[model samples]
Target: MFRVSLLFLILGFTCLSCKSEDKNNVGTTEENIDALLQARYTKLLNYDVDSTAFPRSYSPEKKQIKQVPSKDWTSGFFAGNLWQIYKLTGDSRFKQRAKQWTAFLEKEKFNGRTHDMGFKVFCSFGNGLSVEDNQNFKDVIVKSAKTLSTRFNENIGSIRSWDFGKDRWQFPVIIDNMMNLELLFEATKISGDSSFHKIAVKHANTTLKNHFRPDGSTWHVLDYDTISGQVRGRVTHQGINDDSSWARGQGWAINGYTMAYRYTKDKKYLDRATATADYFIHHKNLPEDGIPYWDFSHPDIPNVSRDVSAGAIVASGLVELYKYTKNDTYLNYSKKVVNSLKTEHYILPKDLEVPFILDHSFGDWSKRHEMDEPIVYGDYYFLQTLLRLKEID
Candidate 1:
């Protein structure tokens, strides 16, 4: 009997040890990721890049880094990634590098030809402002918001999204515009301009009404009749079809509305965010690891590529939503995504000297461009998600 009791006690201690390791595993994973980022980004900073260009994506086959000009929508994400690393590690090396890269985007504040002012300016300058109170960053942000406000049409109660597709669309308003409202909302707080705030709210209200379906999924593009101020057609610019749910578009909806709720304290925005978040987290097609395919409605399920960018964006959004609601579901799923992304399947090889950290992100899946690659915005949001997780820990 005494021997039996000893064996049971030993088993109990082993179980406790297993539980302890499991509890500490998240921190260990995050530390590993931080070490990886330090090594990879150090190489990136050392690599010679043009003053006019920013790292955009990596081509593994060609072993080439894709660089784009400041006018590119993804131009700010690299700078934002550097700033995020600085925020995560308190490394002044990253902060200085971030400043240099961010400077390249200052001209984009005045370029209002496209609706990506928030993507081009806020991600770089806004992140810089969050790190340090630089007057120049504030000025850039306020001006960028003004430039973005030009795209907003009072008749449509929304912002026009693309300029190149004028022949295909009249007064096109994409669901992705929801992500741009942050710049406007922040402009109000910085410049004491209620005009910016009013425009953001109007855009949000119009998007909330027109973009989402009853199932919480959003159509990618809504073309409006300029004179009638009515949605002329619902279409998909990236998804498998007009009816399919593009994973990243859903992520944009979840993140954007949560941010809107943060600025406005409107429960409608909160409700919309929650609905979309729940739809994403509980979707039948979402992989067990918490990563999702390029489109949830893609018929080719397991055969499709996963979008680490979407996973990172949604993970960051879920962390924010968890803070607001204290919902364990949100926190747990965010943690799951972070854990999945830090693994070998999604993480870039350290020996691969690319500017990006994560891999297998789907960019423009319909055109088969940048498919299953390391995109700069993916790294940015992955880093952002890590920072968010660290804050609560």
Candidate 2:
């Protein structure tokens, strides 16, 4: 009778439920996980998030899913996740869903108010193009790069990351800006145009020149005088302090540099990624389970929530770094991190069909926003890490 009920529940009329991790589970192997996630998503349809919009985070306080508009920074991740699932399972259902969700952002190909074009478009369209070779998607990516390039100033040598904070910042460049370069890099490669490539290289060089501390820990944001084209100051928006090694910032450093290396084959980028990874991995505050606290320098150690998002990003990049350097240590470390995530500390319950894959990630510790909850980007990066892990076979 329970199996009959479950079959009916898999149909569209029924909503899925959540499970706590302590409920005793199985399927730790990669193949097992692949089959499980595939079955879960295929059975569990529109409940993940608003099918019309992108998911941002779960508001535990509100006990609801949060969504952002098509123009928002996180808009691409939901569609990107669908495309990734399509790639993993070759399910036409997911592919069709990916196309439908991706279409919501078609207008954003030319929207230039924000610098997250890469995150907004490439993550959705780029991933789709990778598997399907769609020219329409290809054109949207090229146009998105052109739109993103409008924010680049030859004088400033980096794309502007924010439009707000005019009183506090003339031109703000955040380490998170590094993630956007991939769209431009792929644009240049596909279009056979070096313009986008030049912008990416310049942004990368400028970031490398100014963003890193001597120890490879990074300041989250750098403000430059828009007129003078020189740095004005450095600040931390979400970090514990102005000088602390914000865990996600360090993760971004390695992941972004590793991505730049993929396009440029520049040894400097890889070396920078390696240095940042070394700093993050060796930091004393990193937990024994391989998950990192919200910030390495968070004043209250052993009393803070961990950032599974950073762990996912770091592990995904390490898999790429392993390919570049052939270092078993990087691969081994990545495996450890992946293993840790599947552990109860991070993994969701086996029978549940929540949109989120992992939990206990800090959204923003300082603001008390969604702290110790499942994060949208965390789920995306976790999927990326799993996909990378499958490549070893």
The 10-residue segment with the lowest total lDDT in model 1: 8-17
Q: How close is candidate 1 to the true structure, as a TM-score?
A: 0.91
Candidate 2 minimal-lDDT segment of 10 residues: 8-17
- For every candidate, C-alpha RMSD to the true structure in Å: 9.4, 4.8
Best by TM-score: 1
What is the model-wide C-alpha lDDT for candidate 1? 0.84
Where does candidate 2 clash, by residue pair? none
User: How far out, in Å, is residue 331 in model 1?
Assistant: 0.6
Position 281, candidate 2: lDDT: 86
**Candidate 1 lDDT, 263-353, residue by residue in tens:** 9999999999999999999999999988899999999898999999999899999999998999999999988887777655566665665
- For model 2, residues 137-177, the per-residue Cα lDDT tens digits are 98999999999999997898999999998988999999999
